[model samples]
Target: MKKKFLGLLIFITTYASSQTYTTNFNVNTNNKDIKSIVDIWQSYLKTNSKEYWNTAETKDLKNFNILNIEGVINPSLMNWNFSNLILSVNLFSEDSYLIKSIFEGENKSVFAITNVLAKKENGNFKLSNYLFDYTKNWRSHSSENITYFYRPDYILNVEEVSQAEKFYSELCKTFNLKSEKLTYFIAKDCDNIYDILGYEYIFSKGMSKECGYYEIQNNYIFATEKAGANHYHEITHFINKFYPNANYLLLTGVSAYLSGEKAHFGKPLIYHIKRVNEYLEKNKEISLSKPFDFYKLDENTNPQYVIGGLLCDLIIERQGKNGLIEAFKNTKSDEEFLQFLQSKVLKKNENLNDVLRKKIKEISKTDEFPNRLKN
Candidate 1:
């Protein structure tokens, strides 16, 4: 944790150049294991193939687990957006290693660091993930709907555990889908979760340090919140599974609609709507077309979630559950989505942005936003 790559100097001049591609593989001497490590890594850098990504992991696991865990997939040093890459290898044993990659940004000292574990294999080496090794010592608790994993030293929130089980059943019943046991992992803070999963320090584009990801197919959640099964925002992510054929982005809106910042994190979706409205008022030119702003004015909030939730609110308000399901299952393209929104919410002459701003402002005035799931 706290960026463990020590004594690895990054020369900033290379990052200042244009589209310059190279690999700085640093190793002390020529040993068989080190040779294999260099060979496998250089091969990966050259072809950027899936073969390398797959075999680089431990015997029974794939490196893609890290992809699902961290949400950062770097296949090669060939990214056009970054200036240069620095790769350092630290061998824990002849059979184990931790590979750290520091991607230097062109603009400033800002760089993104990612990690992978290299294990010696058949006189060579393969890249593995840090997750399984990290979680081996952790404790677990099983309920009717969740299998919870946590650090041994952590105090289990039994109340939240019960709430999580209750919420899971409620959500399943509301969506008319069978409830499945979710594999939920908890950490004290997000940064701790990152550390256990091979992330050191991630610069949040100079914003808040909030970051986390979940494995949808596996129904695995790696979160920092003690809310566990009671995690409303994340539990609502199951809507995608219920409507597998639905637009995923819209399903995310559904999740944001149900929980957003409330249910455990305090503020409601209306809280975000208010802050975003203030942001819209000051920016003046912010349009509905650009509704997915990553730099959303509120803490850990963005426009896509806010706008889309508002759209969900309007759809359900006008059309109810069946109509909302229709939009979820049928609305595929952005064109279709906009037209659907236009038909449902737009007044005679108002543009999509105009209507969206009005709804956002109206919702902001209320202390609480309507959650259809609660019905």
Candidate 2:
């Protein structure tokens, strides 16, 4: 879940005041566990979530209370300023509980819901995530680049670790970052991803039973097997490590460029390009630069991926990674990014949309197998 461009999520018409955020929930407030949780949520509602975590801060357990907001999310990026209200709480056990809530987001039409686990911590209940708890019984093996987490019943073969190590080493060279041990949580499917990330379920971004999500600030990679051991998409996010200034619209494309594949959809970049080409053939006049929501190419495919990926491919092929590092470091605005492209590397790409399709043609002929990995 890159939450890149158009990370817009749900909004219900209902609204609530700060003190009322936890007032209406039907949990047993009299219980110490519930009371502790109520205090946590009330404080969260009263404060702007942005105050809880900074994407650029150096994260550590000692710093977690100040930085890692929760096991799930910092806040909805678009709805960061929106209000949240607790609707209900269900006790899963004396120590574990489920919470449901709505965010009265900036958008008023679409519906969004969020859920988190509340469990006793140090004898005081706090809003929590199941990431570590869910993995308490899981086994792990360390590699040169990755620390793999999965069920003991699962076979994490040697090939997987080798491939993951190769991807990590390549990305380290690509980013010029000193190599550090990576924390990877590999799972059977996206449900494991959601549960590990402090979600019972999430409705705002819509759910995919399979996907890859990167929590870069904490260096956690939640990926399904479909994402593969060499998941350059989410891996790119962690390796980059510089999120505050990341042009995510471009970063999303960069992720596509590096990963060379899509999770869940489980297709390669060229596979998606062929699908988008079919979409373009139907609407010949459609513009990729403009508001192109024709994302319905498939249930899980997003157009930015293929188009952004191609654009990234073009920039890299034309001017190399340093060129991209230039654009990434300096270009902040989307329009600014395009302007940088036009000024620096726009030879055959003057008509960006057509060129993206043309580039796909160029790639399809020789790139059926992602040659980038072979390098």
Judged by TM-score, which candidate is best? 2
- Mind giving the per-residue lDDT tens digits that candidate 2 earns over 149-251? 8877777777867977887787777777777767788887876666555554455334564566666555667778766566667777764555455455567
lDDT of 1 by residue, 59-150 (tens): 33433545333222222224324543436667766568766665565654645566667776564566666776778798999888789888
Determine the backbone clash count of candidate 2. Answer: 1
Relative to the true structure, how large is the alpha-carbon lDDT of every model? 0.62, 0.60
Query: Which stretches in model 1 have alpha-carbon errors above 4 Å?
Result: 1-25, 44-63, 68-86, 104-110, 121-124, 178-181, 205-211, 226-229, 241-249, 260-266, 280-295, 298-300, 344-351
Q: What is the TM-score of each candidate against the true structure?
A: 0.76, 0.78
